[model samples]
Target: MNSLFLAFIGVGMMAAGFALYSRFLGSKVYRLSAKYATPAHTMEDGVDFVPTNKYVLWGHHFTSVAGAAPIIGPAVAVIWGWVPAFLWVTLGTVFFAGMHDLGVLWASLRHRGQSIGTLSGRYIGARGRNLFLVIIFLLLLMVNTAFATVISKLLVSTPTAVIPTWGAIVVALLIGQAIYRFKWNLPAVSVVGVVSLYTLMVVGDRFPIVLPETVMGIPDRGVWIILLFTYAFAASLLPVWVLLQPRDYINGLQLFVGLIILYGSVLITHPDVVAPTFNDNVPEGTPGIFPLLFVTIACGAVSGFHGVVASGTSSKQLDKETDARFVGYFGAVGEGLLSLGTIIATTAGFKTLANWEEVYNEWSAGGVNAFISGGGSIINEGLGIPTSLSATILATMAILFAATTMDSGVRLQRMVVEEIGQIMGLKISALVATIIAVGVAFALTFSSGADGSGGMLIWPLFGTTNQLMAGLSMAIIAVILTHLRRPAWPVLIPLCFVVTVAMWAALLQLGTLWAGRNWLLLGIDVVIIIAAIWVVVESASAIMRARKAPAVAWSDADTDAPAPHHVG
Candidate 1:
């Protein structure tokens, strides 16, 4: 059978399994007896709270969960083969990610939209809450860095891709400015934003503006990193509707078209899939099917990062608590499906192209100009699309994917700064706090990995790290539910399993880097190991605290922590 159809069967099965796991038996996972439940706190206006519609909440939650991590992680994991990747994406979402996401959303809603970190304090323990926040901040910086790199790499291509990319950036900025500052109509401004981005692609085909791979003898990769950070700085400063959301909407269209083309190629070629499900040669291979895969595909699975979505922007805007269910749970399911589609493309559709090795090399070229040179053959053969257009389409998809996370990372960072500052009793001006946040964001973009830096290596690691955050959150939720004396089995079993796997994955990565003596990778490994240990340690401690603390029922709008760092 053709791989596309095979993919469909596999994905369909995986999805079916997820439903069975989530619905009939999930409450047992959450240990969800009403007695074990969190109180559904009421909302209020101002910084403390605001209500929003589930539709919008779903949109925000989905976009927040959709980031470079899911895309890159699955891509890397699938190198082992689509089967294992599919299995992890499917099973993990059904059992691990779905439960984690629902638990976080439900818990946050119970506590007046308090973030996971803060909720850790109220429900888990004060020290546990601070600890969780530290892990979160580190995870955030890594995420921002990875996505920025991903965008930079995607844009460093033919003049066609580069020009449209830069144009989109400028256009996104202008649209954002118009909407937020000038009070321009949202609908009209979004239209102009789309036109402007598309126009760059169209006009560039004629004028053909390109950013060459290198300038002043700098490696093209370095140039992309620098430019990426510079742009992230500005993008972070702007309002969501303008640059982030509008750009994502336009980019989402590109992702949609690219996926379609990829699926179409698979349908036409019907290539037999040869990729293995797992690679034994890399033994000591990315720790087996537990935390490793779960962590590697965090966004595609369940990400604690979404807790920020549940509590931050989405919660602030939520019109009702019931909306949290679909918005928080199902929207994540949608992104999981999207990533599954890409996995299908990579396994089934990709083989049709004659020279994947060559395409891989091209995609891995020295700078922006490198891919342009290698584009012709792959487009003609494997992808079976015209080079100029396919190149634009592919490049646009990467940019858009990266853009989604950029917004998420930026917003999370802001909340972190705000949250930590409040916890520390530091009264910093909002402007100065923003500057610190921006600077931290930029630093992440500049960091690198062995084969490549930016998004490629870092993002998968980011996924692993992100998954750890999810695992930690799930563990906290399970522990809290248990301590409160409620139905906690469903959440605990998978939550423990996922986190255990994730820890092994992190350990393996740390071992790999330590053995190789690769400085950048070594640094990443060192930091992740530290963070994971701290989170695990704190989580264990939190459960102990929960077991010990008298039932301290939560009240709405309670401001909090003893120095924010140790909260979660």
Candidate 2:
């Protein structure tokens, strides 16, 4: 099969899903209305709740939720075969991720932009809310720790990316100052920001910066990890407009350009699909593809972490309720396109089946490195760009993505920590909360000494834990819809599917952990499974209670103020 044709089919499916299906969702299901003033207006603080342009907000939302998972997950999962990974990315993005992301955004908007974890108490119960917080905290911790390791390793391996990767922070700070302080035109600022970012990439490619093996007695990777968390701590403390918003916005634009380069390479080169559609010969010890495939490819398809990002940060910055469709749904489509590109690069970018097999000899072999090398090759062959520059560009893309996500994840974790403090009858300041969040992440990263390899220890649980988080988020949305007496099957159906699959995957992981005598992970996995099951029970009960209660009449009137118990 021709890679170009497969790529087009995947892109076409996502396009139709956004164009036709998202419309049905916006009007008929979510019933989004511009009249609904989002928290950005109602609670307009200079810090976290300032009204934002939809495009800029979409950039922030898209890149923050993207992280490196979409690239890493699909790039690795193609080991099963391109057919399954491609189908799941397209279909899951359309029916599962689009609705999940958009729904969480809408739910948060209608409730004063409270996070899904906080909203759980109002709809589900105090107990459910507490458990939801646990899931969210764990997920954020995993993201921060794991991504630090990913970024650190990339920095060590691809020294050329170092300058651009860190230089992007300066570009974003300037973009923020230009837009918010100088009041420059947004389009002009955006063009300058993107061009500045790319220029840094080129300069970095020409002059690489390799750190010594030991930087003041710390290994290079460990030093990078410490520096990354330190930056994240500061970035999380700054106001959104100062760093978070602009950094994510520019990174999002740069990422789209990178995607176009990748997708365009496929169309221009018309490479052959060298890997099999379905691999009958499986690597020993590789788990069955059924449930694992769904969890492995969570980000590009459907992810609970997206819910955390949607409700936690994005909703607070949303200027209008209607922008949720674009920022939330279309943002999901953007990631699906990236994931689709990964599938193509890994499966078809290689020259032959034997070459592809060499890279996929083991279950864990194909990851971000595979995507960088393979996709870099395609770009070099198709566009006549040098491989070194292409690799630098892609490496910078991955680094920027991970860094932005780390920014938001740390911020969100800080918010969660503050929430937990409130529950404990203690007041936690933002600075204090941020210190705790970053402190925990840093401790985990260096737990196995300064090498900073400990962060990946619990990463194996991220897939199941993340997918389950998505299901639990859907549970919150479904409960809210039932209370409002509106249609909920759109959320409910996917809710059921995701929860079932994730729970199954968690059980499978439990056995694997137990067999390996990995007691720590096994214990944590047990807690997550139990918390998820308990939340589902609470949500089911909440839905039943809502069905029996008086139904609030749905309305699109401008006067529909968000009420604690109802929205009519």
Of the candidates shown, which would achieve the greatest TM-score relative to the real structure? 2
Question: How well is each residue in 183-264 modelled by candidate 1, as lDDT tens digits?
Answer: 7776576567556666676666556554555567656766776666556666655555556554555554444444555555
Q: Deviation in angstroms for 104 in model 1? A: 2.1
Candidate 2 local lDDT, residue 102: 97
Question: Model 1, which residues run further than 4 Å from truth?
Answer: 10-53, 163-208, 212-227, 246-261, 264-270, 277-292, 351-387, 443-463, 483-486, 518-531, 537-568
What does candidate 2's lDDT look like per residue over 34-132, in tens digits? 887778888889899989999999999999999999999998888888899999999999999999999999988887888999889888878999999
TM-score, candidate 2, is 0.98
lDDT of each: 0.59, 0.91
Off by over 4 Å in 2: 554-568
User: Model 2: which ten-residue window has the lowest total lDDT?
Assistant: 559-568
